[model samples]
Target: MDIINEILSSNILPYVLLGYAISILVVVIMIVLENRNPLKTISWVLVLLLLPGLGFILYIFFGQNFRKEKIIARKGLRNHHRLNNLAYSQISQLTHGSLGDNETARQPTGIVRLLLNNSSSLVTTGNEVTFLNNGKDKFEALLRELKNARHFIHLEYYIFAEDRIGNEVKKILKEKASRGVEVRLIVDDVGSWELKRSFFEEMRNAGVEVYSFLQVRFPLLTSKVNYRNHRKIVVIDGHIGFIGGYNIADRYKEGDAKTYGIWRDTHIMIQGDAVNSLQSIFLTDWYFVSRTELTDPKYFPASQPVSNKVMQIVPSGPDSDWPAIMMGIFHTITSARDYLYIATPYFLPSESVLFALKTAALSGVDVRIIIPEKSDAFITLLCSRSYIREMLEAGVQIYFYQKGFLHAKTVVADDKISIVGSANMDFRSFEQNFEATAFIYDKGAAQEMKATFFKDQSDSEIILLPEWIDRPYIEKVKESFARLFSPLL
Candidate 1:
């Protein structure tokens, strides 16, 4: 006790406090030298000045921007070599008038070219797209396909919780593995932190190879924490695939009703050559996670042209040369002739997307966006509300979903294009996380997506400009405060 009192009374406490203050100052200076986006830099600086301890922790986990780093340099090029060839071949064929009699291909050429130039996303002309709305429909389709798996089953998701839905999936995977069908799974380490080691051990025991994406441990959490694989992809026998925003969790796809009503989401099941593109994405990520490059003729079975639906599985992340999905959305908005419709749970748009929406509306294009009235995140909802006034002033119409949470990320323009995927309409989905979007260039598909949007719109409340302008002063101030940290969110 006397020793502890002496230490507390000594000058060591002051020295420790001085050291912490200096550390915070050094981090702020380092952030400035990084030359990140001006808004993000200012946000970090203000956060540090206000709450030094908590801000530093949040920055370490979520704020580090590694856009200039090439972490996966070696195997990435070799893994994507075949897809790159396909992308170039498609570009050449389109350039030389090979698409002689197809008007569907001509309408989306601008966005197609943007994707090809930026990310080598191949435009697959033969695809059968099936849109699945809500959790029940998607899980039913997924389980049916899984039961028919013959050769291999590949699954990846941001969250693989050990819940009712997850256990159901694991049971199917184990049964498949026991029958000599190769089963592999990838789950994000941070997203699936609630999953215990024993759950994975059971899968491994049953011959299901499970690995976590970007293993997060002490001393390496800073670099790996910010970039998450938010993609949810499932490829069965290299012939059928699924991609969308639904994660493998009870809250995502368990039942009909919950604290938030039914989980309204959208996913697509694709059959034909387009599955090869989704397979390519899965193999690339698998190589990164497990380091086992599975490149064989069996992994990509020769697929025949099924339907005339043109589609491209576009992916974007920190490592991309450009934000392919974001740019494609912007181009669609700018090129919309009649109308632009969108549904997203989050509405924190980046500067370019915000500008495109506003400009399109001002130019006489009908722009409508629907967001959930009750969101899972309160702060995010507030930040989203902060942008509604400006959008309304620019003649953009906004709707609030009243039935339940609107967890679907979709966009349909001029009834000519349909986009559905895991990426949100926020900065993180476009700039920070690894995401995927399927661009279907078919009027039929677009009409179906548009119909779903209308059904949800019927269940929503349209917010008028005057009603929004007359919001409570305290609420507006709260949202304004949250808007200051939009980039971080």
Candidate 2:
């Protein structure tokens, strides 16, 4: 009784009560605002209620408006008329009979169509695709193409380290720019944060035009924390283009000086009409980043036949009201006739995606998934493991790549459809973050992608049901806890 009296008499009571009151108030407000999804709202509220101090920090940093409006406003204004009626005409000609139904039809439904319509073009058929497997081959091809530049070169990437590969590429751009090549380079301020201003200064001094995408400045009116341009695109002479799970860094091509051997990644180098789509994407992004009105005829001059590759570029981010890439995935899985193969490093899929894959597998479609045996993020890996049990039980074949981390995001289905891009199969890429992908309807490309997927699968270790069940008790417990926070992951 004396101890209890002393505790009540102490100053801790007031402070504890004050903290409790404030926390409860914030949680209550969050619940009310996010109440439309009762299950999700309750889950988040429980997290906030249980973790106390740290939960508030997580919610503020990650849960709230991570996508700023001013950025959206700028993008909307810059790209307002780009997706007009003329774009539809191009898509109509590109798709032709596939607009209804053909061997390789693109059915971009719902908000995806709206986003496509906004982009001024729907998914076109007949995209010729060349898949570059290693950085050496990729860089060699890029250099060869860039050297042939006649008009302009627009390059954008999330990571552009000033290492060996980057320096070599910079040298080419500088040489071209000095010869009046109209080179425009845009790098993500956050991802390529380490590129010394001096490196850019050299390129600028050599006549290359450069800009940083979404450079977060403090004392800015909007939420200074949200939004990142995580796209990797390169357009050379407005005829050849590249985009995918590749970046401009020595660590990717030939690895860092310390780490030997090349880092395995997939990048697509496309030619023909497809490059125009990439060029449009660059123009819009450049406009938003620099706020400079640019309409140079050389940047997008009247085109003649350069090559014979048919391709469609898919871009997505927060500005749109709908999740564009997610919709594309949903359509692809739903429409799969024979087989569905997915390879991603991260697989924290939304509920709909989880259902689609599971349903596809259960319905006797050969559903297979490949994920890295190890990942860059440990917690996300656990979250991925949490999905394995149910999926395996449903007859979905899960392969853990044993050779090394499988970072490429590719999906090939039944020799008809193929998707390759930087968008990982996760909640963040699907709904929150910026991403781009290419949907290739060419049979030859689909076959090539499928062949490569199987080749990697040979080196993978398929998880057996018994082995999964016999996983250490601690692992099961960890996955359970990790699964709880999946919505927020």
Candidate 3:
């Protein structure tokens, strides 16, 4: 026993013990200071304990919680409190206004109230909403509106590739700028990493202002990588607005056989007071990137009532106290009476969302989710499978879209309410990235979206619980391992 002890207490044992001590210290610090999700905390602790060196590097790059710092700094620069108060006042007035008298408005009032109380999302009425499915229809309508831009055009996208579609849009912006119309564009630096400064030379020369959000510089690693602006927005003359999942890239459009096959997506075009809200979102992002506040009254022209559709623009990011879009989705799910339909490319959900979905399914509400069979991210695809068995056991029906990559982020409930926008049904979108979504409380719009969901379902293959359970042991192992790192993914 003495001989064994001497071997155990050798130099190697001391170094190993020291490494473990450091990892434990880091874990305690993270648990005490970060105050992140319990599952995420546990995951990080496991990573640190199991793989000390690589885990420390990963934590330094991705696991650090700098949301509080960013939120504080952002609020110091922008009048977020003032804007939030304005939105609250508008929501309060609308809640007590004549619109509340209608029975149509009564159904979604709880959701609207939840949004207002949590995120201060302003509810606007008399907006006309047109749902555009797939990129071809969306870009076609957008091009038509671009041609009709009388005053200004503002566009912001996560991915604005310098491809055929991107160059076409740039050409239109240059033409509009040459005609004395203001054209401003914002693209995410990380998402458009492949794009070069020379790609926008023509537009810049034509007087079109362009900027990249959170541009990364070499040798200075930062937390900006986690806080991306994932919103896709287009505002024309402050009267028409477009928001959804379609990015400014050729892959989103048809005929990109080499990249994505028949890219399926959804976007919404709005013509009413809601456009003002969309314009406000774009201008706020523009100010963040360019440091130029667009506060002119011309950008918020008086909007006439186009329809009786009630809409709210819900924007969420690391700047907020909590995940606004995720909470909105939760409220929408818990408020469902008849049916719920959801389609998203990513499927990883936070614990609260997963619980809500399981509870809803177990309560007899028809719950269905559609996801891509072959996702773009292999690890993400594997991680999504970990939750399938649980959800399936709870009576939730899962469909794997077989026709193409399903990139649409849409939710419709009870054929009366719908949410469509850039925020996917995943943790990255809900917690880390800046995202915008439109909550439409209109029976007609909801029915149309439900119909579209059914059409997509026709092309999807339902996953059976028995077959899923019978999947190979290796696949199950992969899924379990992938799920462990899903929080970071």
User: Whose lDDT is greatest here?
Assistant: 1
lDDT of every model, 2 decimals = 0.88, 0.75, 0.85
The reply for model 3, stretches above 4 Å from the true place, is: 1-24, 71-82, 94-107, 255-260
lDDT of 1: 0.88
Scanning candidate 3 in windows of ten residues, the lowest lDDT window is: 71-80
| lDDT score of residue 91 within candidate 1 | 80
lDDT ranking of the models: 1, 3, 2
How far off is residue 461 in model 2, in Å? 1.0
For every model shown, what is its TM-score relative to the native structure?
0.94, 0.87, 0.92
Q: What's the true lDDT of residue 281 in model 1?
A: 84
Q: Estimate, for each residue in 201-228, the C-alpha lDDT of model 1 and write its tens digit.
A: 9999999999988888979888998888
* Clash totals in order: 0, 6, 0
lDDT of 3 by residue, 1-489 (tens): 987687597867788778768867866686657778888887887787778678777776667776676532345334455557777775776567644436435656777777877777777777899889978799999999999999999999999988899889888999999999999999988999999879767668989999888877744455666678899999999899999999998889873565557899999999998898887678778778777776777988998888888888988887677688999999888988799999999999999899999999999999999998987899999988888999999999999998889999999999888999999888899888889999998889999999999999999999999999998999999999989988887
For each candidate in turn, give its C-alpha RMSD to the true structure in angstroms.
2.3, 4.4, 4.2
Q: Which prediction has more favorable TM-score, 1 or 3?
A: 1
Encode model 2's per-residue lDDT on 316-403: one tens digit a residue. 7766555677787887887787999999988888889999998999899999999987776889999999999999999999999876
Better of 2 and 3 by lDDT: 3
